[model samples]
Target: MHRWMDGVIGALLVLLVLVGALRWVDTTWRPVVVLQSVGPFVVIGLGLLFVGTLLLHRWWMLLPVGVCAAVAWAMALPTFFAHTVPGPANFTVMSANLYYGRANADQVMAAVRAHEVDVLVLTEVTPDVVDRLDTAGLTRLLGHRAGEAHADTFTGTMIYSRLPMTVVSGTANPAIEQTPSLQPEVVLTVDGQQVRLKAAHPMAPIPDQTAQWRAGLTALQRWKGDVPAGDRLVLAGDFNASFGHPGFRQLADGLVDAQRTAGQGWVRTWPVVGRRMPPFVALDHLLSRGLGVVKAGDVAFHGSDHMLVWASYTLR
Candidate 1:
């Protein structure tokens, strides 16, 4: 019976290694993408399993488990170290999902005011929610705005800025077709510099929506690649994809993840309010280029399942 249990444990460990491997491959399959979202946790589990193999005297399983754990750790280690470029943090940005317009407007405004946020990216915004936000003094604070609110569905994305901004149509990427949610891009004039910003909320990779999710991220990658190397760009929102997803990694290639740059290790930003379980994966992100990250972190609000992700940056 002990031998059989050891065999079962070894098999589970092997399966986990396969799941961890998904971080390097692109796939639109629902299960694989879902598992990949928790890549950091998979590395942790792999480490624990490697220890278990030794503690249980499963010598035959030691080599495989140890090697896989080492590989996973090697890949994940860099994300924990600060890569901040030296500069004064003159700009602050925040992204939040409104839980289909259910998130408390007062709480959201309070966060904006507290952070002295220069720009705000919002997802799942509805017409009524926009009114509530204005009522809560959002317009008085930020003033400039772009993107339209959806009256019938949670398809709206908007960028609000204290600096002057105008909505710009994204370069049409054929790779993105029929995506379920709206991703709005705008150009903000900051200190005589033009900074392009996108409020991005790609479709979630649930069972039937996996293909659209993949396309949405692919579109983002193409959009990022098309930007001139010298241009400043920022993409912020509930991406619905993590670093584990190869598509996300591709999109993030030339950009910096604010949280990673600040070395906020394994920060999770979803399911903070309505779920039975604690937040396990980070679906929200702030990715940028031509900006020096000074600090970054997440904030809990009253009603949204997603925590607000904010980052401070300087011109690079």
Candidate 2:
């Protein structure tokens, strides 16, 4: 029985490593192996595997066991620590995937106006929803706004800001043949500085993960780096890539994870259900380049399975 138990635990660990490797390999691979909300399972399973090995007879395997523990611990490093900011001039930035719910958005919009978000970013926005928000007086709540609701739902993304944004450019993706219009980028000016605010929801890693999903990351990075090193930049959305991967590190090359830099806890913002927040795997992020993070947290939740990300920042 003990031998079988050991075998079971060992197999699970091996499975975890393989899953991590696959996540590293590609995004479309997301669906092939993991179906829905796999981040929490991965985090919990790895932790249990490490703990279960302690009672086994083959304790010599402890060396590798320790390595697994350390690796899992490191994967959580980005959001492992919570940060606090000390200041009087505070501005909060929040983002959420609307899921095109007008009624639900009434709650989301009310929350945004009450909080007085400096810049609000949203994706998965439909034409009717946009019109509803317009009629609901979001332009006044935001103090300024830009971008038209898509007529056909090709790209449903928009950024509402209190500082009045100027559309620098929106990338339509010449590389993608299908779903090419979904991801786009925009530039905004706040406090006399141009901040590139990009909202992207790339296709899940299914067919040709690297070429397909990574292409979206590439597009975001292209628009991001378009600005000079001396400007403020904010990249927010569901990056699909979880902990311990190069895909996120690739984006972190010049930007700072806002949750890691200023959050007060492991800011896990996915699978937001029943007012119960889970911190298993960190998705949804508020990242900035050449900007200082002041305040950030899982700011809001409603329709989608993903939570919203909000943070206050200053141009440095």
Candidate 3:
């Protein structure tokens, strides 16, 4: 009976190792995307396997255990190292999804004022919240802005900046029906530098919205702004997808995630379920191509489901 039980444990360990191997090469299979969210959990399972093998005095079993542990670490390696950020930042930026107007206006504005955020990106905007934002006098700090108040749905996206921003002609992508995912291009002249900014919130990656979600990320990946080659480009918002997702990996391959650059990728900013409970995922982000992140992190604000994601960058 003891021999049988040992055989069962060995088989289970081999199965877990195979599952970890599949995650790296199974990108094309859509259903396998669900396993992407559990990459970190695979590491936990590998640790258990290592401990179990030692307890059974099967030293030879360590070979498979080591191989599986190495695979899991490689899958999660990007989260472990910090990308170098050089020089002093000229300005700071922040992004947040306000839970469809449920976030506290006072607290939101307070964070803006306290952080002195130069650029603010908001997702899931509503007419009521827009009015409250205007009333809170954030315009006193952020003078140039663009956002159409949509009363029908939580599809609104807005960007407010301290630098003068002008709408870039013919910059909107009309194929995207989801307003939050629509990339609104604006050129801000900062210290005589032309900085192009775009805010995007892709469709959520739930089972039913996979097509729409992929489309949203694809649109952003294919988007080409009218900015000059020398000008800076900034992409910031709640992408609804993380680095683990294939779509974000494609889009982010061309840009640098500020949190990842600053070694703060583990600081999650969504589903503000509780102060003590760690967030299940990090959904909000700030990305850029021509900027270097000087500092980056997130904070929980009152009433919103998402914590505010903030980053400071220097021209690169």
Candidate 4:
């Protein structure tokens, strides 16, 4: 019994180090990308190491335990130290994925209204729901919007803004038809300056869709790189990739993640479980290149698999 228990503890400690090492080599390979999404679980690895230390009573255990703890802290430091450089918040933006049109529109609207969101982006939008929103007065209420609503697929996406907006790459623009993502680019005159808003929905990085997913990311990268220096840009949506993923990190090269900037990156919004389990991944984001986040967090949306994410940002 003693030998068996010792072996179990030893194996657990080794597994912690192995997982941490795997994360450092984060790749788009199926298993690695999946593991990277749950990178926050490194905390659990630390916990297992702590237990091993208590049970193993071996000097060698301390080495792996310290290594595991270090890795966990390194992964979590950004969430703990996140803060906007220095600025005053001007407006709020929100993003929500409709779970393939299963989300409750009433709940979504309530959250948007409560947050006083100036910009709202929704994915997995269906034409029927678009009609419903219009009938419920959202069309006139929002005033400025863009999207092509489709039915029965997770491809539909829409953007609504209370501010007057000109469709620069979507809505009436024919160029957006070639892109894989349903991202709509719009220019809004905010505080007397032209601010660009983009609603992005990247393809999920699954086995078969990996090529399409990379292409979608490439399109976004090119768009970001092409934006003029004077125009402020904000990108918001369900990226289908976590912050730890290489693709998301690449997307954030020049922009700042609102939640990470506001010290709220630890707040997860996706996979909102129903049976007492809380969310574990942060897949939704509001990223800005010329804005600073004053506040950001997740809001609950009924009947949706993803929680609504909102961010208040200031001109930078």
Candidate 5:
């Protein structure tokens, strides 16, 4: 019986290692992409499996499990170390998905006030939710606004800023043509400096929508590439892809993940309300370039499944 249990544990560990390896593959397959989002958990599972192997006296399996866990840890190590440069916090941005316009507007507004947010990006916004947010004093707090609110679908994204801003045409990449979500870009004048911000809501990588999801991330990558040298850019919203996804990694290549820069390890920000389990994967992000990250964190609201992600940065 002990031998059989050891064999079962070994098989599970092997399967987990294979799943963990998917993070390196740049594929648009729906299942693989979804599985990749749990890469961090896979590392944790490997560690648990190593303990199980040891308890079962499976010495042979220990070496492989330990090595795989080590490799996964190494890959994720950078996010655990602080990379922020010293600078004064001149900007604070927050992002959240409204869960098809069901997120608590008052709670969101309270977060903005508490964080002293300079800019707010919201995804899955609807016309009704926009009205509710306005009633909650969003416009009064952040006078400048851009992006459209859709009534028929949850494709809407909006960016509200305390500073002056103008709606700008987003990337003309054809890949975005198939994306179901609306990605809006805006230019804001922060302390006499032009900063570009985009509210990104990529299609989720589910069956039949994997292609669109990949396209959405690809379009964001194109947008990043199109930015001129020395220009600051911030892409904030429900990206629908976690750091484990290759497409997201590509989009984030030249950008700084605010949470990672602040050395926040394994920060999960999704399914905080509806799921039976606690939040497990971070689907929202505030990725930027040409900025100094001061701090970052997430706050849970009443209705949305996703926690609001906020980051303080210095306009370098």
Candidate 6:
């Protein structure tokens, strides 16, 4: 029994170290799709190490490890609320991904109405749902909306804007069966300035694999060149990769994670309501390179698995 326990402990520690090494390498100069792009591999790895220490009765070692872990987690708390930063342009706009099957569309819609975000981005949106919003008089009620509808599934992607868009990318996902992701893009005037925005909610690795999720990412990535460099960019989505995952690294290469830039700390945005498990890491992110975020916060619950998120940003 002692021998077996030793081997198990050793192996777990080694794996944890390896994951940390990968993340350290990722932070250097590697483009998007590095480990930090998805789930936080460091946190995950350290957690496993702590668990192993506890199980092996390494009380002395566990104490220090526990303290470090607590501090690290404590440092990531700023992202849960919203923040603001001044830039060369307008005051702000916003983005979020509404998982289609979350509790229900009505709850999510109510949040949207209450939040009154300048610009809205939704993923996992179905055409039927969009129709409902349209009928609810979004253009008249909220603002103007542009989105894509798929015959296969009601869910796709969309964007709602208070300002008129000058350029837009998609109200569509990358592509499904020769189709794109159900996301949308809109360009609009905010305070007499034109801002280009992309509201994206890419596929998750769960209920699938890293490879499959990457395929969806590939589609979104391919669209980069089409975006104008002068315009401020906003990319929001529920990318499953934690901070240390390779998949998120790929996408992070081109864009900056709004969470890292503006979020106060390790801001996690998933499973906020009645969560059975602790949110292990940050999943939902609003990112931009040319834009400046003034405020970012997680919307309160709407009976969905994900908490709605919004951020105000200036066009730079």
Each model's lDDT comes to 0.85, 0.63, 0.73, 0.75, 0.86, 0.59
lDDT of 3 at 277: 61
Q: Roughly what TM-score does model 4 have, to 2 decimal places?
A: 0.88
lDDT of 5 by residue, 27-105 (tens): 8877788788888889788878888888878887788888887888887887888888786788899998998899899
TM-score for each of the candidates: 0.92, 0.81, 0.86, 0.88, 0.93, 0.70
Preferred candidate (lDDT higher): 3 or 6 = 3
Clashes of each: 0, 4, 0, 0, 0, 54
Number of the top-ranking candidate, with TM-score as the measure: 5
Give the runs in model 6 whose Cα sits over 4 Å from its true position.
1-12, 19-92, 101-106, 131-137, 150-155, 167-180, 206-209, 272-276
Kindly report which residue pairs in candidate 1 clash with one another: none
Cα deviation of 192, candidate 4, in Å: 0.8
Error of 5 at 60 (Å): 3.1
Ranking by lDDT: 5, 1, 4, 3, 2, 6
- Candidate 4, superposed: residue stretches over 4 Å from native: 1-10, 24-26, 85-88, 171-181, 273-277
TM-score of 3: 0.86
In candidate 6, where is summed lDDT lowest over 10 consecutive residues? 171-180
Candidate 1 has a TM-score of 0.92
Instruction: List all candidate RMSDs to the true structure.
Output: 2.3, 3.7, 3.2, 3.0, 2.1, 5.9
lDDT of 6 by residue, 106-207 (tens): 655666676565566666666666666666555565567777655444246667777667545454433441134655666677777766666655556544
What is candidate 4's local distance difference test score? 0.75
Could you give candidate 1's per-residue lDDT for residues 1-316 as a string of tens digits? Answer: 7799688777878788788877877888888888887788888999898888889888877888888899889988887899887767778999999988888999999999888899999888899889999999999999988777776556777788998887785322334633556777888887888889987877888888888888888888888888899999999998898888888888889888999889887879987986898998889999999999988888999879999999998886
Query: How many clashing pairs in candidate 6?
Result: 54
lDDT of 2 by residue, 1-316 (tens): 8688767777777887666555454444445334323544565667766677776655755566668767766765645565544543335677776654432667677767766688877766777777777787787778655444565543566778777577654545446422344444556766666777766566545555545665666666666666678767777766665544445567667778877777344556655655475544566777787766776666555556666777877664
User: TM-score-based ranking, best first?
Assistant: 5, 1, 4, 3, 2, 6
lDDT of 2: 0.63
